[model samples]
Target: MFFTLSYRKTFIGSFDKIGDAIDKLKQHQESYSAISSPRFRKSRSGEIIRIDYGSSDCYYLIEKGERDDRTIN
Candidate 1:
C-alpha cells in the first residue's frame, strides 16, 4: 500500500510509507502555525465572524494501491 497526503482536497505528495506522509503533514502544520497573521472572515458590521488556525485535522492520509499511478513506488 502507498500513502498520500492531501491538503484542502489537493494532493501534496505521494509517499511509500504512511509514517512519512504523516511526518510531512506535521511539517506543514508547523509551518502554517508560524504565520504571524491570523486568518478569518469578517462581517459587514466589522465584527469578527470566524477565526482560522493551523491544524493537522485538515490533512488527510489516503491509501492507494501500489499499482496506482499516483503511488510513489
Candidate 2:
C-alpha cells in the first residue's frame, strides 16, 4: 500500500510507508500552526470574537491502490 499526504485538498507528497506520511503531515501541521494567527470578527451585537485556525484537521492521509498514478506498475 502507498500513502498520500494532502493539505487543504491539494496533494503534497506520496510515501511508501504510512509512518513516513504521518510524520510529514505532523511536521506540516506544526509549521503551519506556528505561523498561523487568529482572526477577529464582529458579531451581530458588535462584539469581537476570535476565530482560531487549527492545522490538525487540514491535513489528510489517503491510502492509494497499487495502480495509482504515483505508483509504478
Candidate 3:
C-alpha cells in the first residue's frame, strides 16, 4: 500500500528591498503571484498559491501543493 501527504509552508518577514526577495525566489525557479485581496481565492484544481505584500517591506509567502486542503482557497 502507499500513502500521500499534502505539504504547505509560509514565509513572513521584512525585507530591505522587495526586489531582492523576489530575485532570490526567482533563482530557485519558484513560481508565485501577488495576492490581490485580503483573502486567497480558489480557482482551478491547480491554482498557484499567492503571496501578500504588506505595509512597507513586509510580505507573506504561501507555498503551493498538489492538493492543499489546509487553506480556504
- TM-scores of the candidates in the order shown: 0.40, 0.43, 0.26
Model 3's alpha-carbon lDDT is 0.34
Compose the digit string of candidate 3's lDDT tens values, residues 12-70: 32234546644554433333434233332222234233333333322334333333446
lDDT by residue (22-58, candidate 1, tens digit) is 5665566466556444342212223211122334333
Runs off by more than 4 Å, candidate 1:
1-7, 33-59, 66-73
Winner of 1 and 3 under TM-score: 1
Please provide the root mean square deviation of candidate 2 (C-alpha atoms, Å): 12.4
* lDDT score at residue 42, model 3, on the 0-100 scale: 22
Clash statistics: count for each candidate: 0, 0, 0
Candidate 1 pairs with clashing backbones: none
Residue runs of model 3 more than 4 Å from their true location after superposition:
1-7, 10-14, 30-73
lDDT of each: 0.43, 0.43, 0.34
Model 1: how far residue 73 lies from native, Å: 22
